[model samples]
Structures are given as C-alpha cells and as structure tokens.
Target: MRAIWKGAVSFGLVSVPVKLYSATENKDISFRQVHAKDGGRIKYQRVCSLDGEEVAYADIAKGYETEDGEMVILDDSDMADLPATSSREISVEKFVPSEQIDPMLFEKSYYLEPEKVGAKPYALLRKALEESDRMALVTVSLRNRMSLAVLRVREDVIVMQTMMWPDEIRNPDFGAVDVEDAKPAEVKMANMLVETLAGDFDPDEFEDDYREAVEALVKAKIEGGEIKAAPTPAKTGGEVVDLLAALQRSVDAAKTARGESSAEEPVQTSSPSKGTPRKTAKKTATGASAAPRATKKASVKKAPAKTAKKTAKKAS
Candidate 1:
C-alpha cells in the first residue's frame, strides 16, 4: 500500500520517522444516477446562490456562516497560520493504561512503518508498550487539523488510531419505559435458550447474504435466465403474555436445529377431571407420551357443550 503521510514520532529524545498507511477500506458497490429513458449518466454543476452562475473548482473557498447570516470567507493565507498546520511530528503526551481508553472513541486506524534509520528506536518503543501493557497518547495533524490519537501494538507492528473528542459523543436520553420485571421461571427459560445457542464467534461462519443475493440476481439477468419471486415469509410477532412458554419454544427450536433431542422441553398435561390444575411432564427418550393424548381427548369431549352454550347466548 502507498503511504498517506510521512512524519516522525517524538516521545523523549528519540525521534522515529515513520510512514502512515490506512488499515481498512470500504468494499461497498457504487452506482451512479442516470436518465430512465436514455440510460445517460446524470451530472451536476456547482452554481453560486448569489450569482446564479456556474463556479469553477479553483474559485471555491472555505466559508463560515455567522448566526446573523454573514459569511466569513477564508483563503489559503488565512488558513496557513492555524496551529499544528505545519507540524510534522506525532508528539507523544503520555503513556496510559490500555483499558482506560473506550473503544467507541476510536475513529480511524493507520499502520506505522518505521524508516531504515529509525527502525531500532521503533522496535524499542513497541517492546516497551507491550511489556508495560500501555498505549501512548499522541497528538497529530492531518488535513490541516490537529487530532488526538493513540499508538498501540498489533502483532509485530505499531498502529496509530485517531480518536473522537469526548464532546463529540452524545449522551443517551431515552425516557423511562413501563415494563414489568421478568419472573424467575421466564428468566430461567431465557437462560436455557441462551445456553442452547451459545458458541464461540467465528466471523467466517457469517456472510453478507444481501450482497450475494443481489449479485446472483444480476448474473441471472445478464444470462437471460428465468427469475422467480421468493415467497413472503410468515410474520411471528405479537403481544407476548406467556414469556416462559415463548422462551421454551425458542430453546426447543434451537436445539432441534443443532440436531439435539427436543424431549428435554417440559410438556404440560392437564387432568381429565373438571377444574383440575395442569402439571408438567417429560417425554421419554423416544419422544412418546400418553399424557398429551389423554388431555386432547378430554378437551374434545367438553367442546360440544361449550359451543352449544355460546350459540344459545348469541341467539338470546
């Protein structure tokens, strides 16, 4: 990769010259706006609001608008005197414990490659950081702005990651929600469900399904092949009054998908007698049980009388 910046890291009396290269890249597909009828790509021009005329790129200068609608235009000469604008050093302020820095504050990352003359000092710094388990807080200037960044070791290389200011992070302001605490039974079942699905996270096991589908669709269109519309998926969402039952169902489904027996899920069976309470029963190893059939027959025998009474009430 090509280096984006060349600078020296100054920590005490040691100065290590290094080149910075971006550590990550975007892989998203891009598309351009076009005319629907003629397939011509759309283009835009920069027109000034005050003059109603197109402006050239070189004529554009940075401007700041005041609260009362006054524009303060800044030229190259005005920006040349800004602080840190001409600085070529990544000045290390202090070494801090790595855990003290929040991961959310990190913005961009770059790989630091030391020059031939400074390689020994660079290795020394990396070794010190690794042994002390600390990160070096540093100040850097990029694109005419001073930024706070941290230097840490990744594998055998030292990486510099720019950070966002504390004020840039917004505080969460969600109002109170009226939700009841989960019951012990529900929490137990939820724990079971979690255990059934828990495993080490391997990024290779997941994929960008939407991107793959889009590529397949485009390939089919290019090859003049037939395309079929996918069926709409059934929705499974509503007010959940029985959280424990829902959690158990989820655990059973997950276990089944993992090729495990679902017999461990508790089966509820009610007595045949009227006003008798229901009780939990477990299925045998073969998943065969007589309690569920008895409950079904009992419910069937009482359904006709209940239906007749409902019909009579409606008639009245």
Candidate 2:
C-alpha cells in the first residue's frame, strides 16, 4: 500500500522518521443515482444560492460570513498566511493509558512504518511502549488540517489513530422522557434483567442481519429467481402480572435451555397438557419384587471356565 503520510514521531528531543498507511478498509458496495428515462449519467453542478446560477470552479472563493451579512473573502495567499506547523512531524504531547480514551473520539487508524535507517529505533520504541502499556498523544498535520492522534503499538507495528474533537459529539438529552415517578419494582426488575443478559463484548459474533438479507435478495433477483421473505417470528405474549414470578420463570427457562441442572434432577414443567406424549417415570429398584431380566436369551452359548476341581474329577 502507498504511504498516505510521511512524518516523524517526536518525543522529548528525539524524532523517529516514519511513514503512515491506512490500517483498515471498507468493502461495502455503493450505488450512484442515475437517470432512468434516457439512461444518461446524472451530474451535479455548483450553483450560487442567491443568484441561482451555475458557478465555475474558478469563480468559487472561500469566505467568512460576519454579522448582518458582511462577508470577508479569503484568497489562497490569505489562507497561506494562517500559521501552520510543518506536516513532517508527529509531535508527541503526552502519554496516557489507552483505555482512558473514549471509543467515540477515534476517527481513523493508520499503521506507522519506519524508514530503512530508522528500523532499529522503531522496533525498540514499539517494544518499549508494548511493555509499558501506554499510548502517546500526538498531533499530525494532513491535507492542510491538524488532528489529535494516538500512537501505540499494534502487535509488532506502531499504529496512529486520529481522534475527533469533543465538541463534535452530540450531547445526550432524552427529550420528552416520562420518568417522573417510576415504580421501584419496575426499576429493580429492569436492572435484574440487564444483569442477567450482561456478557463480554465480542464483535465477531454480531452481524448485520438486515444487510445480509438485502444482499441475498439482490443476488436472487440477479439470478432470475424469486426472493422468499423470511417469516416474522411470533411476538412474545403480554407482560406477566407478577414481576418476581416472571423473573424466576425466565431464569429457570434459561437454566433449562443451557442444561445446567444435574442429570439426576428431574426438570419441572408448567405446561398444560395438549395431547403431548408424557415421559414414563422409571420404577425404583425396591418398588417391585420382579427380578432384573437378562439381556441375552437362555439358549445362547457361553464359554466354560477351566477349573482344577473339574480336572481332578475328570481324572478320577
């Protein structure tokens, strides 16, 4: 892969020359809007909102709008006058625990590879960071914009992950939420349910079921076959009247489904009889005087054991 950025990892007074390449990729299929009538490709043109006239590339200029519709246009030279640090350095500011960073702030990640002469130092730094379990906060300028990024060891390689600013995240405020007076029992039950369903996060087990279904439908259409829709699962019955009873029932069901009960313990049933075959109870050993039946028929042949007494009797 081609290097997207060429820079140096700067820490204290030391700088390690490195090259950055994207570490992840997206493989999603994309479609473009088209004109169906004439089968002509649709194209977009930039137009001035005030005049409603199409604007050429050369006619466009960056402008800042002030109060009362005042505008200040900035030319290329004016933009160049703005203070910008060199793009050749990834200036490290501080070191922090990787877990301290929120996942939402992460924007993109890139693998950092050292140049030929900097290989030894790169490997040493990556190993040291891996042992220390800390990430470096760094600033990198790319495409005329500066971004806050984290530098850390990804296995044997160094990785740089760009982060978004805090202001970009939307504030959480549940509008019109009716929580004036929630019942204590309801809250307790909800908490219990959540606790019961809690588990370690594993990204591999989750999938986009809707997207897969849509892709399957598209494939079927392309092959000139009918797409069969999956039947919707039956909706669960209404909420139970007793909260504790429901929770206990749910716990019991989950345990039974997972076969957590002992082999000797009989499973309790709450189902109504609907002509289903019932399992016959096994008879206790002492319940009846009947002897255990032999598995083989009485006429089956058996091998005779050799005995000293039998041999003596034969001699006599």
Candidate 3:
C-alpha cells in the first residue's frame, strides 16, 4: 500500500524517521447509485443557495455559522496559525501503560515503516516499547487537523493509532434509562451460558457472512438466476412467559449453530468505490442549440435555375 504520510517519531533526542501506511482496509460489498430508469450515474453540482446558480468548487471555503446567523470564512492563513497543526513531526509527549488509554479514543490505525538510514533507530524504539509494555502518546497533524495518537509495537514494527480529542467524545447522558436489575438466578444462568460458549478469539475462524450473502445476491442479479427471500427467524409467542426458559433455549440454539457454521454476526455495510463529486461547469449565457439552424446546401447549381420557377418561389 502507498504511504499517506511521512514523518518521524520524536522522543527526546531520538528521531525515528518513518513512513505511515493505513493498517486495515474495508472489504465490504458495495453499490453505486444510479438513475433508476436509465442506469446512468447520478450527478450533482455545487450551487449557491442564495442566487440559485451553480458554483465552482474553488469558490467554496470552510465556513462556520454563528448563532447570530453570520458565516465566518476561514482560509489557509487562518489554519496555519493553529498550534502544531502543520508540523510533520509526531512528537512523543510521554509514555503510559497502554491499558490506561480507553479504546474508544482510538480512531484510525497506521503502520509505521522505517525510512532509509532510519531502520536501526526504528527497531530500537519498537524493542523498547515491547519491553516496557507501554504506549507512547504523540501528536500528529494530518489533513490540516491536529490529533492525539499513541505509538505502540505491533509485531516487529511500530503502529500508530490516532485518537479522538476529549471534546469529540460524546457523554452517555442520552442513554440514561432505568430498568429492572438482573436477578441472582438469572445472573447465574448468564454466567453458565457465557462459560459454555466462551472460546479463544480466532479472527480467521470467522467469516463475513453478510458480505458473502450480498456478493451472492449481486452475482445472482448479473447471472439472472433465481433468488429466494432470506429465511426469517422462527416466530415465537410475543410474550416472554418464562425468561429463564427463553435464555436456556437461546443458549442451546447458539451452541447448535456454532457447531454448524463459523459465520457469526450478520452486520453489513456499503463500501462503494470512491467517486469524484460532480462540479458545476461554468454556465454560458448564450445557447445556439435552442435556436433553429438554416440547412445550407449546394444544389446542382440549379442551372441558374429556371428564373421563372425561382422567381415564383421567391415571390411565394
């Protein structure tokens, strides 16, 4: 994969020059939106809201609207003044236990590769991180935004996981709900169920059944094959007559399904190829296409054509 950013991991006097590449990639089946009637790709244009005219992409700027209904436009000059934003250096702030950092803060992960003549120091830092069992907190500026990140050892290389800022994380106040607490007997049954189904997480053992199913559907459409509706879950009495009985049945069914297939969760997502956003073409004022055109042709030099007929036609 191509490296998106090139920078160094700076800690004290040590500087490990490295290239950053995305560690993971999305593999979900996807689709492109098109005109339902003609199958043509849908296009959109940037338009000025006030004038009702198409606008060019270059004319657009980042704007923040105020509560007083005023737009504040910001350009490159304004961004350049931000703290450590344009800095390419991933400056290591400090070292802390990896567990101390909440996983929710982590956003994107990148694989760090050592550049030429920087391999030795890169390996040194990787080894040090592995031995210490701690992750290095750092700051990286990407795409005109400054972000906090953590550098950790993964395999023989160092991986940087960019984190969300504290302000970006939403509070759990929206989830304030009070429900009946679990009973001791139900909790005991839950523990037994967990133990019965618990196993080591082998990522390879799992398959993306949803993606496979979607791909199969796409293939069927292309090949003009028969497609049956997905099997719906067996309906049961809506009322839960016995909570323990329901839990026991679910556990037994899960065990049987586990023995049958490796497919787990059926979560699906769209992953269409990136398409270029439509930009408005400069609108021209005149349109000759709407006006009629004269059909100009050279007739067999109509023998100066019978002056009488030409004169008659001209008169008519």
Q: Which candidate wins on TM-score?
A: 3
Ranking by lDDT: 1, 3, 2
Model 1 bad stretches (over 4 Å): 66-71, 176-189, 222-316
Q: List the residue pairs that clash in candidate 2.
A: none
Model 2, range 1-316, lDDT digits (tens) per residue?
A: 9998787888887778999899999856566443343222344445566544446789899999999899999999998999776678899899889789898999999999999978977887788789888998898997778889998887789989999998998877777678858899999998999999999999999987877887887897968854332222223332321232223334444454556752332333444256632321111211110111110111011212232223223433
The candidate maximizing lDDT is 1
Task: Give the residue spans of candidate 3 off by over 4 A.
Answer: 67-70, 75-84, 175-180, 225-316
TM-score for all models, in order of appearance = 0.62, 0.60, 0.65
Q: Relative to the true structure, how large is the alpha-carbon lDDT of every model?
A: 0.72, 0.65, 0.66
Residue-level error in angstroms, candidate 1, position 124: 2.3
lDDT value, candidate 1, whole model = 0.72
lDDT (Cα, 0-100) at 171 in candidate 3: 88
Cα lDDT of candidate 2 equals 0.65
Q: Is candidate 1 or candidate 2 better by TM-score?
A: 1
The regions of model 2 sitting more than 4 angstroms off are: 66-71, 173-188, 225-316
Clashing pairs in 3: 302-305
